[model samples]
Target: MLSLRTRGKSGIYYIRGSVSLNRQTIDVKEFSTGTSDKDAASHVMAQYQMQLHNELLFGPTAKVADVTFSPEM
Candidate 1:
């Protein structure tokens, strides 16, 4: 599950979490939302979570296949 935390005296909010896939635990820690507002941070956290979920559900994302490469002499 995802969590929010503050570093020391800093009021900035960050996201930390872990997801288990294929018997391996991937820890996503200290992801900065760049804001002190909890609402904003929650929005950012949701985006990150969706990204992670897509990667896990569909495997690694590949974009190079969409690009055309030209041969160099």
Candidate 2:
């Protein structure tokens, strides 16, 4: 499931979620939707979630994400 949260006081929204495949869980990191507006952010986040779903189901044929956030090592 995907969820949105405000980033500090910036008014910007970010997405976070997790998906499971073959009993393996993938934790999607928080990703910026690049918009402060909740409605716009939700739209963008839905697209992203769909992309992820397609890729997982269709074996990488889906479009790749432009931005990926991984914790700095």
> What global local distance difference test value does model 1 have?
0.75
Per-residue CA lDDT of model 1 for 1-73, tens digit only, reads 7888876576889899876667656589678899988899899988777666656655655233334788998
Model 2 misplacement above 4 A = 21-24, 64-73
* CA lDDT of every candidate: 0.75, 0.79
In Å, residue 73's CA in model 1 sits off its true spot by 30
For all predicted structures, in order, the TM-scores are 0.70, 0.73
Give the runs in model 1 whose Cα sits over 4 Å from its true position: 8-10, 21-24, 62-73
> Model 1 Cα displacement at 3 (Å)?
0.5
lDDT (C-alpha) at residue 62 in model 1: 24
